[model samples]
Target: MSVSVRTRALTAADGTLSHRYMALRSLMKICVKRRSVVTFLALFTLSVVLINTIPLLPKETMRLPPRDLKGSTSKRLPAGTPSTLLDLPPPLNGHKNKLFSGSSAIPFKQPLSHSVKAPVTSQAAKTLNSSNSTRLCQQKCIRDGGGHASVAVGEAEMTQQTVREVSGEETAHERKPDSFWKRRSHSFAGKESIPRDRMRGEKSDLCQISVGKWNETTPESLPWLSAGDVRKMAFLSGGVVLSKARVPGHGQVLQVGLGAGEAEAEAEAVLDHRQHCQSGSCALIKRPSDWFEVLAFHLDRVLELNRSLPSVLRNFKSKLLPYRYISGNARPVVWWDPDIQHLAEVDNDQNSFSLSWPLYQKVLQSRCGARVSLNATPCVGVQHSEWGRLALFDFLLQVNDRLDRYCCGFRPDPSDICLENLLHVKCKSPNDLLLVHILVRRADPSRLVFIDNAGRPHHPHDNLNFRLVEGIDEFPERAVSILRSGCLESMLLRSLSADRELWESRGGAEGLRPIIRTIQQRGTILLQHIQNRILRLNKDL
Candidate 1:
């Protein structure tokens, strides 16, 4: 009986052990199944946290943004004008320019003739705008960059820009910033709001170039900075130059960075009776005008005078500007860079040029081909043609700003005052001199800079205007050659016609006709005048 009972108990114990082992094995399998999914979930959460938060924090030292974002700011300080305002469309996109190949030119991209129309709204402008700090630097948080989402958004913007180009419908409403909206809630404190649709000088036609992401793929050439880079350069002294600011009701003048001699020039000009005069008649003061700036750039390019500092017409409205130009108006802004700045005078003596006061008078008194005392003494780096290039342009434009501004010095003729001795450079201010509209070639200084050439215009017979020569005798070889070739008429006309939209916007064809006619008329008059002057000077000599 005992053996039978013990055997039964052992059997029961074995059965119980088998059941428990089976249950344990099943539990282990279940745990293994859940572990993989748990690990994946944890990894995903960590990744999401890392992506969104890491890039958003302000760094101890943020890397300098791409050139496109940190564009050179306008240094010209706030200056108010009369009701007359200048508006410019955005930088154009298109083919590389053939006009001025040697000097860097902002080649405009032309839209197709058969255009389609797109609806321009406040939102569109923000998405496609050029000057916003945020838009310029928002690349870090974007996913994969190659992802479908980014591609879709970019394609959409480009498509819209194309459509607008075809339609020729421009003018966009201004959208307030998110921070602005948050700050104001309802009202903009210390700011007067202007309606975007009614925003004067609003242009919808402006579109950005299709520059792709940097470093993601191999580049074809050195990356060209966006228009914003050039447009938004550092304005070291941007503000109402108290030294030159007008009375509250009189006007406002905002100067950006004041380079070496600009401050002294401004002070001198303010006090000196010269800046207030034009056409041999001096007024108490002359109201500042945008004509000299915007028009000067266009004219320089047409004439292929690459000596001028690069300038572009920009349009924006902010309290930073004067009241007259605060409503999305256009104004000409110069981009002066130290990197490209060259001295206005070189050490080479062979390139030395000499001009006596009498020759200066002859240029004013004579006409064309007068063969004034321009001795072709071979100077090393100075070419008569180069200096004459800017001189001829100044004459055509009636420039009267630069004269007697240089510290006298030219080899073999240090005692004699010559135009080639224009010593005050744009980058460095002279202790006793003023630097006016000038840009010297980094490679050579004898090359005259025609930048900011726009200044007080003089009468045709005003013996004091025209470049280099205070007097008009004979037109330089550069001028006569260019004029006789009949290139002026076509080049000038093409330049005007090419940017017909800007002309029309600023002034319709009827309004522009007079200016065009006047320019052409001046050319004819100039030729005749030069011919007469040349004959007189030759006989006198």
Candidate 2:
């Protein structure tokens, strides 16, 4: 009986082992069938996470803010007004209401004149014909302070009366045969005298002249002049000084002598030749206030004056300083040799193009001296895409518009020859990209600086250094190629090296770590989903 039990136990053990082998085989088969589905799901999840995480990555890798924003801070108070309370209008329905009551103000109405009397002398009639006749009389009247008001008006009115008297007097002086009664009738009409008060008031009416002295207690005693006070001062100065002097010709050139200098010489020549004095005289003592005025006057002329004169004499003395003038806004003055007729006209539409003013300036400085003639042919190379062409055109238009507005006498030609071949030849290295960025930074450093949420300074770098990968020929082109080559990791690595501290401070490292963790977690979840699906399939099997 013991031998029989042992045989049964061994048989049962073998059957159990066989059952386990069969289950293992079925599991392997299920895994093979669902392998593709599981892999696809895992890849899909990873791609979704990567796409979502891209924008969150920190752009700057170097520099840091003066302070961190991790903790709460006190809110800043609003800025106080600089103007005094007295300078501002009184509060609604305040003292101003009582001061300017309608009934208390006096109305000074001027009287009208009817007929004017003739001048007695011929010499007086001759003086009346001159342009300064009214001016002389007005001056005398102002000096008398209303004492000579009637006399001034009488002098002006007598001139008109003299013309009528001349017709009667002309016949009498020539001893003409006209009757005395006829001459008497003419003389009576000419001598019809209007009252002095009426004539004086009529003359003063045109000017609306007022003669009143301000007492020490008057509001005029205030330290500052109001708009009305300024207007009154301008009026008192006479309309002659206020009017713009009329020049005879539209294209006339005014030669201004500027002290010796290269800039001054060029400006003088530009003015001497009567080239559009877009920038008037470099020697002009008057200074313009803003960009509009600068454009109206011309930069070259302004620069010349800055070089020639003292700070006190220079217009816009602050802007004329060598390093102070920003360069990116300047329009490129393209020059091409007319002799190079054999070169095919470049189709600007076919290529993408951008200009680095600093790089171009460096090239010019190195190859040609400071006073180098820019008449040499310029080669341009641009990418063959619609967007590239659009960008190039937009840049060109911006340049031209700025030049037209600000650069005096600069007129960009639309039909200049493009040195397409030269651009391809010159910009054939990754260093060119660095040079461009450096130039842009030099032009406007604020553009690249980081600003925190509270509008505080975030990144502060004195200077930037760029690293280029080996075997890359053109910097900009290589950058674009790297972006296209799905080498975003390498590209970002290169960019971050420029400013690593910035990336760390902005939680870029932390943000990327989370993304990586999410990707791994998603992989595990995908595996679980696959295992569950396989179990369901086996149950069906």
Candidate 3:
């Protein structure tokens, strides 16, 4: 039995060994297959990398000319030209006279006075005199050139002498004084000539000659003057008319021309003359009606301000006066006022007067020193919460009472008063807090309720949780849409937190953790309110 057990154990051991050899061979085959797969993957990855890197290598090489060639070429040529050297033609000889012949004959030196020669003959002299006179007179006034005046006087004398020789008849026409003064006066009025010798009294008669009569009388009087009488008169008067003829009624007519009620044609002529005249005495006069119109407009605005004072006072008290109830730790809010002293008195509660119609009239009188117009229309008044109403009544009564005592004055027209527009009052005093009040009014076009700060519109829907304080009235549609959309919460949070780096570096209001936390909490509530409102609206729709 022991031998048979031994044979069976040996056979089992051989079978177990054969099984272990087969498993070992299979394991080797799997390892070989895995190694081959890994090797193939590694080789494939390296080829891809090399293929990608090949295009990055440089494709071209450049060669430059030698330094000596470059330097020699640059030195021999002008800048920007190709640097090629070349031979030139020989210089010309015996051309000295050709260079200097043409311009040498003309002398450039100034001639001496005595060396200047006269015209050769009497005809030439006459020609020269006439030509010089004509050139001197070229569109210039007779008074501008003394040479032309002298020539004109000589020609006139010569003409008179020739006329006396030809006619020889002395008549009453010849005895009459010449109309030269009348002509001069008319021409001077037209600014075509200058009136000279006014202060010397020699031209006094000429000045008295009326511009209007001169234009009419010249043609009628010319036939009465005889040539011999004119020559004798000219000889006695230095060959020129000295004393001007006295024209009847000329002074009265000239006075009438200067006075009001002149015809439009005459006035226009006078204005044209005045505009062109070199004299500094003439000036443009402003009309009385225009001046009155400007004054009326200015006073009208002042009156508007005066009439609107009661409303503004009421609004101020209702909307802004309660800011005093806020905690001392709250952010400092400033109010600007036209009168600092009056504002202080009101703030201190020194005035506790009740506001009534009679009191309003008295307060308006005391502040503006003018009667309020009964015809003035009232602006839309404030719609207030309970807190707002109590605050406003107290504020208005205080302001009114203070105005009755300490305020300087109020404007006649509130529209023109533009308290905020004034430089001295702009956002300066506590009473000026009117700037923050948002006034609600009826829109001109859409007739919707509008809220405005000062005069600018603010959108109410922009901040849904934002309660309109007593003074605010105008709200924009876009702002309302934003609030309805529930986007303002995220916007407010981002705006408040965005300047973190600046806050950290400067140590400003960023450290006010309580205010920041309050704002964040308020934003969350606002968002929830907006969402709820939107859902309700959607359900209703």
Per-model TM-score on C-alpha atoms: 0.34, 0.13, 0.15
Top of the candidates by lDDT: 1
Please, what are the lDDT tens digits per residue for candidate 3 over residues 298-337? 1111111101110010001112123432222111111111
Candidate 1 on 201-262: residue-level lDDT in tens? 12111111112332222111211222332232222112222122232222433333222244
Model 3 TM-score?
0.15
**What lDDT does the true structure give each of the candidates?**
0.34, 0.24, 0.24
Tens digit of lDDT per residue, candidate 2, span 1-541? 9999999999999999999999999999999879978999999999999998878653211111112222122221122211100011112221111111111112121121221233233434333433343444345334413323223223333333211111111111111222111111121122233222222222332222222221112223221223343233222211111011112231221122322344544544434322322222122112112112211111111111110011111111223322322222221111111111121224221112333433433432332211233333231221112112121111211222211111111222333111322332333342333121111122322111100001001111111001111111111111121111111221122222222222332344333333222222222222222222221100000
lDDT of 1 at 432: 41
How much is 370 displaced in model 3, in angstroms? Answer: 30
Worst 10 residues of 3 by lDDT: 306-315
- Give the candidates in order of TM-score, highest first: 1, 3, 2
Worst ten-residue run, lDDT, model 2?
Answer: 449-458
Clashes of each: 49, 15, 40
lDDT of 1: 0.34
